[model samples]
Target: MTDRILLTCGEPAGIGPELAPLALESGVDFVWIGDPRHLPEGTAYHEVVAPSDPVPEGRLPVLPHDFAAPATPGRPDPANAPDVIEVIARAVDLIMRGESRAMTTLPISKQALKEGAGFGFPGHTEYLADLAGGVPVAMMLASTTVTPPCRVVPATIHIPLSQVPDALTDRVLEQAIRITHAALIRDFGIAAPRIAVAGLNPHAGEGGTIGHEEIRRFRPLLDRLRAEGMQIAGPLPADTMFHPPARSRYDAAICAYHDQALIPIKTLDFAGGVNVTLGLPFIRTSPDHGTAFDIAGQGRADPASTIAALRMARDMAANRA
Candidate 1:
């Protein structure tokens, strides 16, 4: 076990491999776990026997895992899908064993993994949750550069907008709120976290004119949590909850849907946003964006989010149990 963070190189065919060399600019102590061959040609790297090995300056420390095939820019090899899945599991094992202080994952293509390797999980969050004994978790996108950092958690994710009404049960919203609240205190070191809840419809149902979900279920849920001494505000209109004044009123915003939460933060800090999974046993953070197959091998891939993810992971790990 080492004090450094263990980074998993996700989707070799994507820009994940190339970003490692660029993320080094953040100067956070971390080692990458992936096939060295997948890295951009002419990259400086050294193979380490264990995760605890110290990395030399100007070189990436690779805990190598060979893939079934070579990676091509802008294209994923289904033949290497199982290998990609294995790398994530291996990284999980290292972290669970306390071999690293935290974990930072690059982006991955769920389609490729599912079609090639029969991946059953929805995405990294679900798979990681299953791996950690089916513990409940929430996805939070946290801005790294904003004046008052913007943090958001979408109660319902990866589901169609029409399906949101049926999917976002009182149980789901309550769990997301509990997880986000606990994580704000545990991982972020906030003594009294104020969570702002966003409504499911415009104008927060306009007092039941636009929609009833806000008045029917949302308000009741917030009332319960507030009675427990939680500083909760809203079932407010999602439209007006993200402006500077609204943002300053809460530590994190719990939105009704994915776009409601992500659109505001991604618009606020595109490059410096980091995706954090709340309620996980081990610390995990990732770049808010996905695999940029369009610029895989090109030198145009920016490392801002990756660096932010690393720094955020370090900060969270320092506050862990």
Candidate 2:
């Protein structure tokens, strides 16, 4: 049986619900896992069932769940938090059971989740790792252009800059590299990917003046990874690594922390950036942007990112299958 992609429109309060119809029209075969009530009135939908249901025709198929009171755009209700998480869990189960091939999640608001559901972890990456039985996961931001092609994995995610050094370790760096390399080959179809490791300090520590992490931790990891015959480079300066010419030299960039990796990619392709979680047993992708609370109900939400996410999810699922 061909695997259908599962798309979870996160919080109904955000743009997730709004972007559903556009994503459905993108020629990707997927099951919408959310409340049917959130979709535009009169929109045709089919209920998802156990033991694999046939793909519904002429309308987007929906795997419905009982969500809290009617959804109000831009205004999240704490009462609905558990229901939102339940949908995600079901989608994950579908993938694990081989009923689905991949998942593309719409943006979800963390604040709303915590207030609504008593959620833990900063965001999806951490939550997903936990859900998948504690496999270590790395978030990679990818774009379509191979000329100046870039894939970024931040070593220290969602933590303050002050805490980065303590978190940076030889094992962590090596593990991140392995995950990125595997994902490139498995999901992106790259073979023997060459990776560039960005430095933790300014000017890559300016010979250890700015930070010793470059001298003590990053350099050793680079040496080890290189000896292992991984086509890897750098403890190079972060600022210099992202320039067009520099980025063209490798398959992916491994950065020391969140901002180091994300800043460059977000600047280069804000609307098209896709967040991919590597090392999961199943393919999981999402729009790089978050739930746009400010413009939630205004019909001003741009569906470009979500569309890109669905397309990428389809590609990954096809490749994996």
Best by lDDT: 1
Residue pairs with backbone atoms closer than 3 Å in model 2 (clashes) = none
- What are the per-residue Cα lDDT tens digits for candidate 2 across 23-89? 7667877778888888766777778674257765777778788898778887888888888888888
lDDT of 1 by residue, 221-267 (tens): 89989999999998988888888888889999998899999999999
Judge candidate 1 against the unseen true structure and give its global Cα lDDT, from 0 to 1: 0.91
User: Number of clashes in model 1?
Assistant: 0
TM-score of 2: 0.95
Candidate 2 regions exceeding 4 Å error are 50-52, 55-58, 145-147
TM-score of each: 0.98, 0.95
Top model by TM-score, which number? 1
Off by over 4 Å in 1: none
Once model 2 is optimally superposed onto the true structure by TM-score, how far is the C-alpha of residue 94 displaced, in angstroms?
A: 1.0
